[model samples]
Target: MQALKEAQKTVVSNAPSAIFPANLDVEYVISFRYANGGQPAQTGDSSTPEEQLEKLLHTLDLAGLRTVVRDGGDGTLLIFTRIRSEKKLLGEIYRSRVRDWLHGIRPAAPEKETQQSIEKEPLTDGERLRLVYSLITLPNSEGGAGITPKQGEWNLVQSIFALHDHDFNKKWLKDWSTKWLIGPEDLKVIRDRFGEKIAFYFAFIQWYFIALTVPAAIGLFAYLFLPAYSSFFAICNCLWSVLFVEYWKRQEIDLAVQWGVRHCSTVQRKRAEFQFDAEATDPVTGEKIRYFPAYRRLMRQLIQVPFALVAATCLAAIIAGVFSIEIFLVEVYNGPLKMILKFLPTVLLSVFIPIVSTILTNFATRLTEFENYENQDSYEAALTQKIFILNFITGYFPLFLTAFVYVPFGEILVPYLDVLNVTVQHFGHDEKYTTSDTGFQINPSRLKAQMIYFVVTAQVVGFVLETILPQVKRTVFKKAKEFDSRRKGIDTQTVLDPPEEKKFLERVRHESELEVYDVTVDLREMCMQVSIFKRWEV
Candidate 1:
């Protein structure tokens, strides 16, 4: 106990504040046995688990550091000590350590040295951040504990999430309106506070917005000044849209590398709901995990291609019927209740689109299940890809029909709708309602108008649907429940006569209010955002 305590003192005392940022302190895995011996019999260490835990608490208390302890369930303890310094001070400390390391002088005690002495000094703030981040990511052999959930000797590390910096997010939103620039430091702050997955999304969004500015400016200029050359702008817009999607794919790869999650998917554990035919041991780690054959999964995935084709055919047929009805009513027909009849297709679409989408989504879910992805990330990614395809067809195919088929060839196509011209005698009008030689005057300006509506009006509607509608539904449901309870004379409110019971019930209520949405919802939002951007580009 004395030796371990002495070692702990040495480590804490000699630890230079330069090696780790004050606010971003290093977490340690204190695994030694306690002297009182609550641990299972081990030949080497004299201490018990309880004794070790007490010693750890005593040592931390003596050092005047606040420690958070997590029980690892297998006689292991995870500790996070409170020690922080200003960012500027940390930079200076790192620089000093670099100098000492280069000159063959030890900056701190051997036990406190986390990184090897480097001859090269980090020059810029970005480089310094990288150096610090790299140090933090290294393994214990390389001077960093690299302590994370499912990593290192303390592999079952509990997740320790810091409180979100809502202030920073608010400031970022305010700044984004005027600044139009999101720096790496801002992304780093997010990555440090949140996980890398979320940070990657923010980075990608920022990158996408910056990339979009050039095309948007050019497209707007062409649209205003070169009205006669509309096709030129349309072609350029399509090309730019394609380029953005392709660029984002590569950008994802780059960000994955920067975030050190390039092959992180490979290390991810299988989802708890996943089923397997057999179990196998990992060759390197000797851990038992459920196993499924890759070939069989691939064969299962081939089923999605046929499903996608079927969905696309159904969607295309619906879009075509809706577009044809719209054209016939708007241009060819001159009859009573014209405006009301024109909305028939739209009303039908509004009613049926959701039904079709839900059916297709359920089918996609089944396909994904059959594919049997090992991890949640992989499962979500595959499912999101399938959903994006469906959303793309339903959301954009109508516009595509208007752009490519209707506008370009409307002169020939609208006349075909007059196949009923021969049967006009049945109406008893005697004067035939045959189509005129001029056919329908298809205005190209309508496409631009539709694009404008989609960009501005549709997005506002979508936002209300995505965010406000759910809350509205929830509020209505809760109110209805309350009304029913009142009618039954059931008191929903807890009586607070007993303080202990009240506190316990209140804790339970608070926990109940914390909701976790299905992963698919988050991925769907991301997919929809991408689709919205693509629509704007088109």
Candidate 2:
């Protein structure tokens, strides 16, 4: 028995261990691609892709980060980053905690005895990633590698992102999908796994979802019991809106505190893209901070006023013109191919709104960049506000025109829509196709039908477009790429992955290909939904 046990132990020790590939040690990934789509020049300044990559590696080394470069396929190089010293990370964590405490963002001071005491608490994935990101992106003067991807000397750098924890993501998705409701603990898990920005978005969504139940119930009751445009229901909805806004403000603060990110805005790092005109010493901290002239930023901001007006004018004109044409086709005109012509307005809206919105969004982005806010938070906030304005016009204006203008004063507006009467007649339509028909009666159900379409049908369609369509497109594209590679007789597997670390490398490569997830997009969707719900309910 003793001899058998010894042999078993020896066999167990000799056997290859299973590869878990947790990937917890990897802090960040830097993706580099050749600008000219070929091998880098042998001799050049950091202007060359190869030279820039070398400089980046040197900077990372100086900042005490471990880096391993690998072929990312498609003439790209992936730099996997890890911390060389836990002590360095611990020190950064300690300093951050201390700053938070000083700024009243954190409730308690960090351990005074030693940095190891701070390490005892252990950094969450979010914290670790954030620190590493800052370490890589902050200015060289601020003790970072100062390698901002696609910026200045690092233009060859395609993207810098942290790898997703596939295990945690799978578990999280399964847990959430299984559960009926997400509790505070679930939110905390999200905060720990992701970061405050993403966590706050989810928290807000959860809060919004719960709060909506009241309005939804009330709206159902009102729909069933009350007359159209009931004053009582309107008042109730208005009250609910006020209460929701006030409570969310309080809840937002509470969540910020709970997540230990309250007053985090105070410690926002200077944006790498921020262009500064001068430097000044902070009165309180006595630190030298880069300064951009307020007057110049103010001048740039003033441009938004005109931009908003132009955007509103353009979008409203398109919507109003489309609405008029649709009314003429459906209500007034008895033209040839009338059913097919009725869908013209829908086609025009589908084609025009997106093109116009894209242009406006791009312009808004440029305007925001020109404003040159000191930090990313402010820049994003400004851009969001601008985009929200554009969205508000495009989203709500049509509904507003239908409900307020068409429904209320359709008899008057119907005559004005006769501007298309000549055009309809010229298209070989009969005289009855014109608005001169006496039989035409304004459809009161039109507004109700439109509301239903927006509230139910539009929501479903938006979900399909936002979630399902993107996923389907990604899968199709991936399969197409694989097929193309196989047809070309290229060994995609061997080219991208080595046998020893194939699983881990494959995971990294997959994550590298994913677009950086923006919490703002989700938040914007939520905000738009709220607007739709508010209008629909009232």
- Residues 426-474, candidate 2: write the lDDT tens digits: 8656675555566557888887777777777777867876778777877
TM-score of each: 0.58, 0.86
lDDT of each: 0.57, 0.76
- Once fitted onto the true fold, the runs of candidate 2 whose alpha carbons sit more than 4 angstroms away are 1-21, 35-46, 114-116, 281-286, 416-439, 472-496
Q: How well is each residue in 213-252 modelled by candidate 1, as lDDT tens digits?
A: 8677877788688765477776887777788878888988
Q: CA shift at 224, candidate 1, in angstroms?
A: 3.5
After TM-score superposition, what is the CA distance of residue 378 in candidate 2 from its true location, in Å? 1.9
The predictions' CA RMSDs to the true structure, in order, are 12.7, 6.5
Model 2 residue 30 CA deviation (Å) reads 1.7
Poorest 10 consecutive residues by lDDT, candidate 1: 28-37
Which model scores highest in TM-score? 2
